[model samples]
Every structure is written in structure tokens, then in C-alpha cells.
Target chain A: MARLTTPLTDFYAVIPAGGIGSRLWPLSRADAPKFLHDLTGSGSSLLKDTWDRLAPLAGEQRVMVVTGRAHRAAVEEQLPELADLNVVLESEPRDSSAAIGLAAAILEKREPGVIIGSFAADHVIKGTRFFNMAVAEAVEAARAGFIATIGIVPTEPAIGFGYIHATEETELEGAPSALKVDSFVEKPNAHTAEEYVESGDYLWNAGMFITKAAVLLEELAKTQPELHAGVVALAEVWDDHAKRGPAVDKIWPTLKKIAIDYAVAEPAAAAGKLVVIPGEFDWDDVGDFASIAKLHSSGYKKDLAILGEGARVLSDASSGILITDTGRTIALVGVKDIVVVDTPDALLVTTTANAQKVKSVVDALRISGRDDVL
Target chain B: MARLTTPLTDFYAVIPAGGIGSRLWPLSRADAPKFLHDLTGSGSSLLKDTWDRLAPLAGEQRVMVVTGRAHRAAVEEQLPELADLNVVLESEPRDSSAAIGLAAAILEKREPGVIIGSFAADHVIKGTRFFNMAVAEAVEAARAGFIATIGIVPTEPAIGFGYIHATEETELEGAPSALKVDSFVEKPNAHTAEEYVESGDYLWNAGMFITKAAVLLEELAKTQPELHAGVVALAEVWDDHAKRGPAVDKIWPTLKKIAIDYAVAEPAAAAGKLVVIPGEFDWDDVGDFASIAKLHSSGYKKDLAILGEGARVLSDASSGILITDTGRTIALVGVKDIVVVDTPDALLVTTTANAQKVKSVVDALRISGRDDVL
Candidate 1:
């Protein structure tokens, strides 16, 4: 942690911002998705928080945010210090691989050997000191030409996220704790998640990757040649500043819709060109109201967690979350683990046990022709 | 039911409207009560429903409604056909004894041998044909010099309502089914309610009473002389039209705040002067969300019962009542027997099992100084 303050001048943080998070229901809609919300109750949107976390390490010049065009204005409004060149507006979604690959290609063209770390815009991370230290180590490992990922030390058997299997006793010169990557696995059931926790060799894949920009593009060129050529062709003309828009409009939609985990990370791990650096920081995707409630409880002692401003609540024997932004008072009685989301146009009531099924509510509404609320 | 179509010309119906219904919070508030809302999902309000149910039996001119002075304007708005003189406005709350006693005394003065029936404005009565037949028989028994009460045939062992104990059938002309009421019992325990239901002698005391106005006043005079005298003095000037307001303002607050059951019906039943005509009508006090949900299900087969207009509901695996007038769409997933009430300033979420405890939400609001919402 002591050697972490010098600032990684060559580091570029790339934020791939997507996902509607339907499991969060009325709060996270299609037009105004999860990355745009202030899920931490910190009075700042998650996109801005992501910028805040990254800008300190890479400065605004090297910090980049790639989001859909619908959210570009909101992202600009939230991050007042962000320069226009650092923000990439997608014409449409083409999944994580295309989004992150384009950022890696552009930064590699901007400054070859520039170290880039991609972090999701909607995730919450605590213990900034430990995160800074882990990123410093990952940057050191990335300089050794290995695509380095910061794996979170598992605190519980969370069945909501993907896990990374790291083999022991392998290290990079500058990073003492860097280990060889074995595989990237899917979200497990409760029993398998518990077994993974007990193994002590697995960590949660935070979808955070640190590597030299040239190394990421080289790997993409080796595995997905067409995708690499398309992004690299756009990145070459991006700084010409005149042909950038036309070049992106022509080539962006043709890129494949696939996640980076499937396109690059898994194959690289299988080929022994991937490395894992474990991070000791608290993180959550804020997947549902239950996760937000748990995050909210860490700040207060009340059994009930109330979000939004100036909304009064009177609850009894209830453990749940009540969310309202319209200044409407919510009164809950004799309900446990219930989720009440009160907005101006919609209201949703269910329990935490049905957290994952909240997407079904959106699906049902879509099927019922409630597109206005959606 | 065939003998019920002819109008009961001499029967004056008195509707005593009160009770804020704290158990149905956010929907039932201090400024606007349950009786003013359309809890039935019908186009009209409960007060108007009460008027609609009574107008066919006793013409609009003979129907009387007694309510608080604060609700006088709303009552007038809902019951536009009601004559100005027929609306008895209480200066303040003096409970049912004084409210109904004044209506009875006034109707007795307006028409000398008038038979008056007191029905609650907030109760729901189905099977109008059978209800009319029962009231006709009760009126006949009332004409025979006995105070008559309608006893609802219990369909379940509900422990929420009082039971009426009736003895062997007595001889009454034109009222063959009328039996002498032995006593009026309070709400019983679950076991006691089951026993009372099995005994075949007990019926639910629906708080509906019919009698000659003169007989009711005389019984009131015998049991509670001071209360009877105060109401009688007020009634004497009530039809003076000019002096009615000043007279009621002077004498109203002096009367005791006691229910009519304790003041006259219970004592009269013990003295063998009370008779019960068993009614085979579907009756509900509309006590809580469960009752309203049940009433709603009988009309529509949807798992969720939505009350009022302009509420779009998408529910899955849920059965309960959703009351919203704010035009907000409510999406419920995986919850059963849930009660969600969405208003402009407040919202409430609970289940049918906790219906009776909703008053505690109001109590908690009062304790927490949220009087604006309450």
C-alpha cells in the first residue's frame, strides 16, 4: 500500500457502461439503466463514481467512459470534468467484448504500451486503499505482458457472480502475489458456491482487467481477428477528429455482440497467457433491492432501509427496503424482507426472496403492453 | 322475496356514517374516511351505495343520513337526492346512541307512527331481494310493538363480529320467522365463535335495527333517560327549520358518547321486547383489506382485486387488494394476499394476515409527527 501513491501515469481506465438490470425493476429501466442510478445513496450516479475512482489514478486525459448514446447526456452532466474526447458514445449495444475492445484499440493507438484497466460503471467498491494497492500490483503484472485481472477475495458464498480459479505458486517480477489463471467459471448454485468458497483458490471475477493496451489488442487479433480489425480500423481514424464519426457509424454496428469473458479472458486463461491478482476490497453489483438493502444497512442500524429524499417511513417488525423519490410517505407493517419501490409513474411491491424474479415483472409488463412505464 | 317489491311507505331509513377505519390506512384518512371512498370498486362511493340500497325501500324523501359536520359537504355531494332536512349533521362526535337517537326522535316527530331502520353507511349488503324481504318482516315485527333487529346468517365462524342469541319463535302477525332475541353478545373468541355457529341459535349482530321511532325513543327513555331527553329536545326544534341549527348546536355535545347497542338494544333484548328477523343476505362490514379483496373477487376473477379507477396492475401468483387512484401502475410478483395502497401523499404495503395491525402504522405515524399524511 505504501508504494501505491506514486500514480500510474501510463494507466488508462476504460469503463464499459451497459446493462438495464431488470432485476432492479422500476428503478433500473431501459432508457435510464442501472449505471445511471445513485445506487449507493451517495448522491452521485454510479457512472460518476466510476469516473471519480478512476480519474484519481489515470487523470481525466486517460479516463474513458463508453456508454450508449441515450445515456451520453446524463453521463456528461454527471461528470462535469470529463472531456468530450474521453467519452465514447455507442450507436447501439454490441456487448462487453466490442465495447472494451474498441477502448483498448483506441488507447493503444493513442499511446502504445499504455496500461488499460476496464471496470464496470455500475459496481460499488469499498476499501479504496486496498483497491489502489491491488491495481498497482495488476499494473506491475500487466507490464510483464500477461493480461492481469483483479479477483476479489470471496467473503461469502454469493451465487450471483462468476468466479475465477487461480493456480498457486506463480508470480510476475514486480507483483509478488500474481498467480497463474486456471479458468473462468459461471455463476454457481449455492452448494457449488460454498465449495468454491471453501477451496480458497477461487475469487469473484469483478470483470476488471488490467493489461498493456497492445497486449489486449494482440490477444483479440489472435482470437477474434475480424473484431480486432474492425476496432483497430476505427481507432486509427478516431484521432483524425474529422472522419471519426463516419468511421464509427459504418463499422460499429457490424461488430459481434459477445462478452469479453467469452471472447478473450477464458481463451487466454486456457492458453496460460492470463494471470490473477486477488483484491481485498468490498464490492457489489447492486443486483437487486436486497443487495441495496444490505449496502444500506452497513451505514445505519435500523432494520428497514429507506432511500430517496424527505420520504417519511413508519414501519413495524419489518425488515426490507422502501424506495421513493416523489416525497411520498411509505408505511409498512408486519412485512418481512419486502421491497417497495414508489416512483412517480410506477410502484412495485414484493419481497427480497423474489429478487431475481423481478425481471419477470418487467417481462410481464412488456407482454401486457405497458411500454410507457417500461 | 316476492313480498318485498312494494315500497315500505312508512319506513324511514337512517344511515349513521362515522368511523375513520384506521385498519385501512393511507386509503382511510382523517379528512377523508372509508365511507367516502369506493372500496367496492363500483363507480359510486360507499355512502352513495348506502343511499342507493335504501332509496328503493323508503323513497329519497324518507331516507335520512347522520354524519359529522366536517363531512356534511361530502355527504351532500355524494347523496345529492337527499332532502336538506333529511341530512342530520352532528356538531361533534357523540357516538351512535346520540346520533341515531336524534334521527329516531326527529322522524318520530316528522311522522308520528313512522318505522325507522338504522343501517351503517360503511357496510356492504348483497342479495338485495333477500335483504328487502328481511327488512319487510322486521318492519312487520316492529309494527307489532317490538324493537326489531336483522341477524345475518353466519357463513363462517368469524370472531370479529358480535353474535345475537335468539330464543324460541314467538307469535307475530305477518312475521312468521321473527324470534324473540334473548341477548346481545360481544365479539367472541375463535372457539366460542365456532360453538355459537354450531348452536343454531346465534346470528351475527349486523348492527342493523328497525322499529317504530316512538318505540325506540320510549325504550331509550326507559334505559337512558338523560340521553333521550337531550335528543328529544333537539328533535322538537329540528323541523322548525329556522331554529334547528341553534337547537342542535346547543344540545348535541351534552349527550353521552355511547353506542346504541349498549344504550337500548342489549337491555331491551334482556327484557324480551327485542326480536330478530334472520336475514339471508351477503353482508360484510368491509372491515379490512381481506374483506374488500373478497368482495372484489366475487365480481371479477382476477387474482388481484384492484379498487378505484385509473390503476394498472400486473400481478403474478398474488391474491389481494390494490387500491390506487394516482394513476400509477403497480407490479406485484410472487406475493400472495398483499395489500398495496397508493395515494398521492402516502403508500401502504402489507398482507392479509396483517390486515388488523395496519392501525399501528397510523399510531406510529402519529407518534412520529407525520400528521400531514395521516
Candidate 2:
């Protein structure tokens, strides 16, 4: 993979940052979502990390973020270099279809045929060189008028993510490694995931999509015309601050809530208009403590991984991950694969195997009307 | 079982309050040991509960506490009804032999042939009627010049406690249920403990000893003459406040460090001067979180036992014990048999199977010079 020093021409980056991240409750809350948190233990937050990764490829002036109004201040605070016009705020979440669709419509209105790449703000990526290489190839495939998605090389038979099946028979011009997508599949069960990993043609869909703004809008118009019309109407008035508020207030609520994968990628793949770019970069969504444990396992001491600044922890015959935000000293004894998240106001204890079940705790708290903690 | 309303005549209660209780770390610290904590969630400290239980049997005036100098203020604060003369404090710990012997020597000096029953301050007991019946019968055996011990009926093959072997062939005259002690054994391995439980002749020693103060001192004179002489010397001037400090400071350091089980009980049992009284009351030493879990299992919700006042906890498919002192909300998800102790300065996470290993965490903290948390 070659590292590109110069920014790609006519390329715009759109970050869709919205999710309650209930599985990471107490650490990732409703008001403070996962993207705003420095879950990687890096000095910068996930949002800032995403910005840093994309700024070299898309340039600072061409980067945009679409987030809920509640997180607008946090996004702006985390990325001070972001232009005010590029900060698109939603009154409420309408899911990925509206978020990315509106960004594509706005970018298309700003500059015709602008190649826009949409990436999630909360995902963690390593190997910036490979990431840049894959994005550049995806951009080339996008310039040839095809919706291109970066399919992450399968590292394990992970059932937590959707898969993209691509055939090597048809390769796109200019994009040397691009392959024709056969289909987009939903999250599979353990047996199916194992088969998919063994097949070598399946890749984990990391939700990285690159396409010309016109091409994405065209696909959305074909699959979800009502949502496409709602976004296009809002995009026409988005630059006009005077008309933007009323337009969003009227049109945003009327848009059908759907994910971009379902609204465009699946339909486009079915119609033979989508291509997959193989991405060899290491990626993690940081979806649960198990993902977190895997990310920080390299820094484990006595088989225990501890995350936080100046955290005091003592472990004896213990193998676990401790995420502490408080000044209290945590002691672990004779535990294995445990996850302890200790915050000032709340504490969560579970195991890495049951990391996905933490959402039930949040559900319980919500049902019991503990909105104060939620 | 019968309950006695009136205080027993000529009967005195001695409480030996000591031990760091490292197994309950973060909840029990060196400065504040287990006896000072309200571990049972009964709104009273263990020492206070011991005083309340014994005050009815032995009048408040006849109750005595022997603890380290550091815990004197806490003991006094928890038991305001305790007389100043009865609050005996050792400058440093010298094991139970010295602590209990000094109390016996002092009571003998105040009144010869006075019957004193020594009970630990940290043990939990239920069925007050059965406990009173056992204690009354033990007192009768004590009056017959035999060292009487309340032996708990075996509920399980618990290897954590010592056992007393009692023969059903010989019985005491005054105490109808009293049996002759064959021998007292130290803590055994799992196989031996299982065998002891199956034999039906072995009983768990709850360390409840009832004997005449003069007889205890006489027995101590035979087995441990030096310790007996030292306690007698300290007891001579214990009432004189002006001379007490210098006497304790001089004699305490020279006293032998030995547990009463080794110095008195084992030797007396071998000499056929010990008797065991069956106690059917539910008793727990509260040795670790496992014991704490068993003691409070009846109040468990969803197989989880919680011990704290006004603690906010949410459990989802979790079976464990949570002992929290902080205002933080503790949420347990998909964890089984876990033990979480959350305090202001320190937090502890372990399992009921590994509860005893918590002492190793304290040891590590001490070795690492983290005395502030210890």
C-alpha cells in the first residue's frame, strides 16, 4: 500500500455520528455518546481520531459531520477545525439513510459530481496507509459512477457484523483491487459466519461507502423516493440559515427512518451498480467491552487490561479488563475475562462473553424510570 | 429451646474483638476492622450486635470487651452502654490467648470463681432462643468445673473452621445435653472435613467458651504459665488508671502470642476437662464474601444478595453479592456468583469461589506501598 501525501481532488468526507451505545452504558451514555469518548485510551476522542484520519485525504474544508442537535456542541468542541457550515445538526435521529442521504444531497448541491465518502464516527481504524489506499481506490471506483464500499478483510468468523459478498471475476477500471459485489447480507449466525469466513469471498461490511453525490442520491431516489425527496428538500434550504430551521422541522420528521445499507447499498448491489474495495486495515467498531478488551489486551498486566488515567488497580490471579474513570482503587481477585467499568456515578460488572447483554441492564434501567442514570 | 428473660447470675460475657478481615478488603481495612462494620445490614456494627445479644444474658455491667488500643474509640462509640472499666484495650495484638486470658484474670481479681463466657465480636447468629438455651447449658457445665464450648451442628463440610470431636457416651450431670470432648482438631483438608461431617461425631467450633475465670487461669497456669503470670500482673493494676498504662506498656510486650484454642482448649480436651454443648442455632463467622452471601441469601433477589443501606443496584441475569458503600449505582449483567464491594476509596471485584483470595490483593497493595488504599 502506498501512502498518499496530497489530498484527493473533489472528495468530501461525511461522518454520520449517532447512536445511544447502550451496550457501553455508564461509559457511553445518551447525552455523551460513544463517538465523543476516548475509548481507545488515546489522548484524542473517537470523533477527533476520525477527523484526523480523513483530513489528509478529504482536506479540512471538505469534511462534514451529521449528528443530533444534542451532540452538536460536543462535536464542535472535539473538532475545533471543523467549519460551522460543515456541522449539520439533526433535531432528532432518523437513522443512517437520512443522515448520509442529506449529506450527499447537500454536497451535490454545493459542488456537482463531488465524490463523497461516508464513514461512521465511532469506528476505530489502525494502519492509516492501508485505509488511505482503500479509500483512494474506492474514490476511483466512485468516479467511474459505481457506489463503492470498503469491505474489511475477515480476521475472524465474527457474527456481530454484516457481510459483503464480492466476486473477483469483474474488476473495475482505474480501481485495480475493486471487485463486483454479488450481494449484501445481514448479520449472520455463528454457523453462517464461519462458512462465510471460510469461503474467502465474504468481507465484513464496515459501513464505509464512497460514491459521487449524484450516484448516491440516484440510488436513494430509486429505493426510497420519499426519504430522498425529504432530504433533497432539506438540502436545498440547508445552506440558507433562515429557511433551514423550518425546512428541517417539517421534512425531517416525515422522512422514512432506515439505514443507508438497506436504503441504497443492498438495492444497488442487487442492480449490479455497486463494487467492493478490499480493505486490509484493522478495524473495530468498539461495540462492546469485549471489543474494548481486545483493543487494550496488548497493554495487559498479569492478564488484566486497565484503562484510565492514573487509575489505581491491584490484581491477584485475575484476568480481566477494568475501565475506571473514578479515583478509587480497584482490586480484582481470581476473576477471568471480567469487565469492570467504574465511573463516579455508576459501575458496571460483567464478563467479556456477556458483553452484548449489557444492553439489557440499560433496558431495565429505562423501564424502571431511571432516566437520571440513562 | 427455651429463652430466658432474666440475666444470668454470676455470669460475665467477654468479647475478643480483633483480626484485620483481609478477605473483605475495600470494605474492611486495617484501621477499621470487621467488627466495626455493619456487614449484616442490620443498622448496627458487629460489636454492637454482640453487645445487644449478650446484654440480655449477662447484664450490661458484667460485659467486657478486649480489643486493640486503635479500636477502643470505635467500640465505645458503638456501645454507649458499656462501662468504662469494662473496656480493656491492648496496645498491640498478642493473639486470643493473651486477650482472653487478661479478661479472665481481671474478672477473677474483681470476683473469684466468676463465670465468664468469651464470644467473638464478628460472628453472626440467628435463633436467639436456641442460642440462649445453649449458653445456659454451657454455663451449667462451667459451674461443674468443666470448660464448656458451644459446638455448632455440621451443615456442610466446611474446611474453613476448626472442629471439635465430642463423644456421646459420657454426659455432664447439670447440663443434660453436654457431651465429653474427645479432641479438638485444627482446620482439615477437604477429604478429612467431609469424613468429619459424615461421621456425625464432629462439630464446628464457634469459639464460644464458657468457664470459671479461676479455672481458666488455673488451666492457663499449667499449659502457658508465662502468659498466665503476665495477665495476672496486668490485671493487678488494671483498675488503677494511673498505674495501668505503665503496667500494660511493660507486661504486654512480654506476653506470649498464642490462640486460646492451642493454649487452653486442646490441652483441656486432652485432659478430659472439656465438654461440648450442642447448638442448633444458625451461625456464621462471616469469614469471606461466600459466608456473607450465605448469611444473606434468604433476602436475595434474582439470586443476588445485596448488603447496604439505600444502595441503588440493577441486576440482569446476575447471581452474586454486592456490598456497596458509595452513592454509585452498581449494575451487574450476566455475572454469576460474583462479589463486588464498592467503597469510597477502594473497589473490590471477585467471585464467591475466590472470596478468600481477596486477601492476596491486599497483600499486593501493601507490598507496592499503597497503604493509603489498604
Candidate 3:
């Protein structure tokens, strides 16, 4: 916990860490957003989990975090072992594309021919052994001149994620499950998701992408030429240490706001230059309260998913999640499929069926000028 | 606020306050039961409401509250105007029959012809004008050597309360609405409740009984002789302040536990000496969280019934109640008919339909040795 000590690896891991996670409101807020919360009941924040997952592969010095300027202190505090130079700070949000592109550029400039894998700071991935195996395959595929995405084999007919279609096996060495990407589809309806699951060709696009730093820049240059040049310029000044502030303030605001998917993945797939490492590891985005409920209700809780510091008393209650950070005893009676999140300043009650619509409550509160709560 | 100043009526009022209100658990606890809580959100507790309704007719000196010894301080603190000698504190709970009979015997010993009306401490009643009129009629009927019970005209076919079957219209000169009670029936099933509501001869037995102290003692002597004689002997010693404690210590523990309705009302009805004064008034026992929700979902909140302090931001929620004493902001999404009660140490979440089953939760917690929350 005090210092970072691990064997060195060539490839750097980049975490694009920013999002309010408005759908998990009351628990997730602008001041302390999704990445800062321990939504998975794993006793650490999602940002910390991301660090723990990547640190073994890349070492603490090689694992870079790209986050908003407002969250720089929090990121540094959470990842105490993170090297000062490895923390990439943006003046304001420019979306996933610019954030990850900046990290790729910095790593490419510092060490030539370096490979980097971009992961979001607020995702939950289980089975570290399987994840490490998939990442190793992804690294091999990335070095073989392909933009590699770690596509999780779909466990259920989930419509909440984009689907990566793997068409045929590739002849990539050291990566047995590497497949040529057919296309990437947007989140589908239930029927389409069911069809995708049944077809056995579709994997959930977990937004994990491994690529040679120069290759990603090359693809970015072709798809989003201006954004690529801007990140490259910021990366050059970022390495100078003293000039990062002025450089970020000048270029980050002008960078076109877009996600990495629209900026690189879609175009790379269309050009037939994308390969996917099919990963059977259990993964979840922890997208909403419903997902968290699912995580806790798996084994320990057959009926009630209790998280944080509190006791629970259930009477005729079957399925629900109760999260209490305020040390309050929760009693549930005759309710099912419910979610109750209790904090000091705010409390939330909703059913898992309506979890996706929680963002509307945050929006409503914002409209009413209750920014103090939001 | 300080002292009693009203002129006393001939009949004294006895508030038999002892039930823990287990149905309204977490909010109503053994330490602070329903009578001590402001279930109506009207700024005063139910016990205070009962006193407000009765203090006009019987001065504070004449109003006696018979409660368990543990609640003596709470009762005295809430009713500061009440005379200390008028507070009857029992060593332990012995049910309504002993609690009320003791009050009657004490009043009868103070004055041989005294009429005393026993009222429960936790029922909510609206229209003070109607309540005053009913009490006036019942008092007149009580002086006519009949046990007068105020039966509420049923507004709905509720299976939650006992029924009073009145057969013949009585010719009591001052009490025009006095009807000869054929019998007192226990809480019936839905089918019988609906049938009785349509029959136009049955009224809800609200357990408001007015009788000559001697008549109540005489009836208790018939049905529960041992309990009646014990309370009478205790009353005799109670007049002498010094001997009261030893007398209660000796006799209170020997009194048999029973409800006044079973010991007196039912047996007196069989003897053709019970008369019911039918009174129509808005009344609720505040039996559960569902009743409290109905109270608040009256004029403004057509959907969400909110009680106590704090603010709520709701989305797609209807027909639910949220009770929060803490100043936490509550956000509820897409839930209907839900009951959420939040306190400093405990929380309860249930549906209004299942509000009656909250005691099971308390039992569960107690079984788990969580008495601190209960």
C-alpha cells in the first residue's frame, strides 16, 4: 500500500477515467462520480480496482491514468503508487477518444514501439487469471498490426452493451482465440440481443482496446486527423513536464468531443483492420444500480443484496438490494426487485426494473435547482 | 402549556395507554410507542391528541392515565398539566381490563357516584365537534346506570375492527342516539365485514366505554372477580399515598390480564345492560404505515405521501409513502404503493398493501439479537 514494486513490462495500460455516472444517482454525483465509488462491494473504489487489475501487467510506473482536472487530486489520492508523470490531466472533458488518445501519444513518445491497452476506470471484471490471459492474447494481436479489442463472450442476452462480431479465426501466433472483427453493432433491442447471443458469433464489446501506440495514432490520424494531431502536440509538451498545463489549456478545449468507438473502432472495423481477443472472463460495466444488485445477489445473497456497513432484517421480502454507508439498520418487508441506497446527504429507493431510468431523477433534481443534492 | 385551568366535568377520563403498536414497528418501538409519535404529522403525538380531545371535558386533575411503570415519566412529561396523584403507573402490563378497572376503582373511591370513560391513547379522531357531542351523549347515558360505549358509524367495510350490533333504539331522555347493544363482535373476515356494513345495524367498536365506576366494577366482579377485588383493594390504599406503593406491589402482580371488551362489554351486552351511542366521525387507529400514508395522501399529494422533515425528488412514483425524520433527500423512481420509513438508526421499506406485516420484521431482528434497532 505504501510503494509500487513490480517487475517491468513493455506495454503500458491506460485508464480513461471520467464520468458522473448519473444513472446511479444519489450514490454517484458530480463531486464524487462513478470512478470514485466502490459500487462493486469489493471494498475499494472502481478506480482502485482498475489500478489493481492493470498494475500487475504494466507495473505501477507504466499504468497511466487520464482524468479531468477536477478529479486529479482524487485520482492521485486513490492511486498513491502512480508515478507523477504517468497521471494525464485534462483541463476539461473532451470525451473518451481524446483522453485515451492522449495517453497513447504520451506512452508512444516516452518509449518508441510501445503497446498500450485502454480500459475505463469504472468497469468490473472478475476472474483475473482469465482477464490476464485475454489481455496477453490481445497484446499479441496488437503487436501483429491489428487494433485489438477484448470482446467478452456474452453470458446473457443483454441489450445494454454493443456487440462485437467475430467472423473468422486469425493466424495470429501466441493468441489462440484471436478472431478477425466483422463489425461492431450498437446496443440492440431484446430480440436482436437474443439473436446475437444465440448466433454464438457476437461478444460484448467491453470498450477494451489494445493497440501499438503508433498504430492507434495512425488509425486516429486517418479517422479523426485533427484530434490525433492535437493529442500528439499535447503529449510532446506533456513529456516536458513544465509545459503540460499551458499545452492542455490551449488544445484540450478545441479537441472535438467524441468517444473512442466513434473515433477509432467503427472506422477501424470498416477498414477490416480490427481483431478481437474473445474473452470468457466475467465482466460488467456496473452501469446502474440494477447491475450492482445482480453482482451481490449472485451467491452470498439469494434474496437481499446487502452492501456497506449495516444490518438487514427481512420479512417476506424476496429479491432486493440494500446499500447503507450511513450505518443504519435496513428492514425490508413484502418488497421484491427493489434497490435502496442510503448515504448521509441523500437516499434513493427504486426497483431493479426501473434502474435504467434513474438518470431522469438526477435530471429532474437538476432542473429544480437542487444542485446541493445532485 | 404549563398547568390545568379548565372546569371539571362530573365524569373523569381514563386513558389506557400501553400497547407498543407493534404493527408500526421501527417508528413505534417499546421505548416510544405509537401513542408518543405524531402519526398524523399534526405537530403533536397521538397521546397529546387524546388529551387535547378530553381536557376540555375533564380538567387535567380529573384525567387519569393508567400506563406501565416504564412509561410514567413519558406520560407525565407529555402532559405536564396532569396531577402526579392522577397518574396510575402499573408495575407491569396486565392488559386493558386491569388497566381500566384500576382507574374506575380509584375514581369510585375518590367519589362514590363518579362516572369514568375509558379511551385508548393511540386512536386518531377528526372533527372535535362531533367527538364532543358523542362524549356528551355517552356521559348522559352512563349516568342512567348503563355501560355506554361510543360506536363509530362505519364509513367502509373494514375487517380490521370489531363490530357493535345495536338492536333496539333506547329511550334514554338526554341521549337520543343511545341504542341497546345486542352484542359486541370480534374483528370479522372481509365477507362478514362487507355484509355487516350493508346491514345498517352494525357500528365499529372503537373501544370508547363510559360507565358508572361502580357499574364497571360490578361487571368486572361478575366476569373477573379476582381482578376487580385486587384493583378495589389497591384503590383503597392508593388514597393513602404512603401505602399505595406496597399495595400495588402486592395486588398489581396478582390481577389477571384481560381486555376490557372481553371482560365487561361482551358480558354486559349479554346481561342487557350495555347501551351503544352511535357516533359518526372521521377516525383512524393509525394502525400501520399504510394508515399514515392515507392521512398524508389527502389534499396535495395524490401519489406520494411524504411525512416529517426532508425533501423528496420522485420520478414516475405514485401511491407510495416516504417517512423520513432525517434531513436526507429521498429520491424514489418508478415505485408504487411503497412505504419507506427512515430513522436515524433504522430504515423500513415495504408496500402499503403489506404494511400490516411489519411486526414480522421486528420479530426477525429480535431473533437476531438486534434489540438496539427495535
Best by TM-score: 1
Q: Candidate 3's C-alpha lDDT?
A: 0.87
TM-score of each: 0.95, 0.95, 0.91
Comparison by TM-score, 2 against 3, better one? 2
Those runs of model 1 whose alpha carbons end farther than 4 Å from true positions after fitting are A1-3, A299-302, B298-302
What is the C-alpha lDDT profile of model 2 across B1-374, one tens digit per residue? 35688999999999999887988888888899999998788989988989999999999999999998999889899999999989999899999999999999999999998999999999998888889999999999999999999999988999889999997644666588899999988889999999999999999999999999998999999999999999999999999989999999999999999999999999999998999998998888999998898777775634999888889999878887999878788899888999999999999999999988888888888998999987
Root-mean-square deviation per candidate: 2.2, 2.4, 4.3
Model 1 scores what on Cα lDDT? 0.88
Residue range with the least summed lDDT across 10 consecutive positions in model 1 chain B: B1-10
What is model 2's DockQ versus the real complex?
A: 0.82
Give the CAPRI class of candidate 3: medium
Answer with 1 or 3, whichever has the higher DockQ: 1
C-alpha DockQ for predicted model 3 = 0.71
What are the runs in model 2 whose C-alpha is more than 4 Å off? A298-302, B1-3, B168-170, B298-302
lDDT of 3 by residue, A1-374 (tens): 11224432678999989888998888888888999988777889999999999999888788999888789889999999999888888788889999999888888998989999999899999998788888888888888989999999999999889999987999889778899999999999999999999999999999999999999999999989999999999988887767978887789999999999998998998888899998878999989988999887875444878777544545475577877788777778878898888888888889998999889888888988989988
Query: What TM-scores result for chain A when each predicted structure is judged separately against the true chain A?
Result: 0.96, 0.97, 0.94
Off by over 4 Å in 3: A1-9, A41-44, A68-81, A166-170, A173-176, A223-226, A299-302, A310-312, B1-8, B59-61, B68-85, B299-302, B313-315
Task: Output the lDDT of residue B128, model 1.
Answer: 84
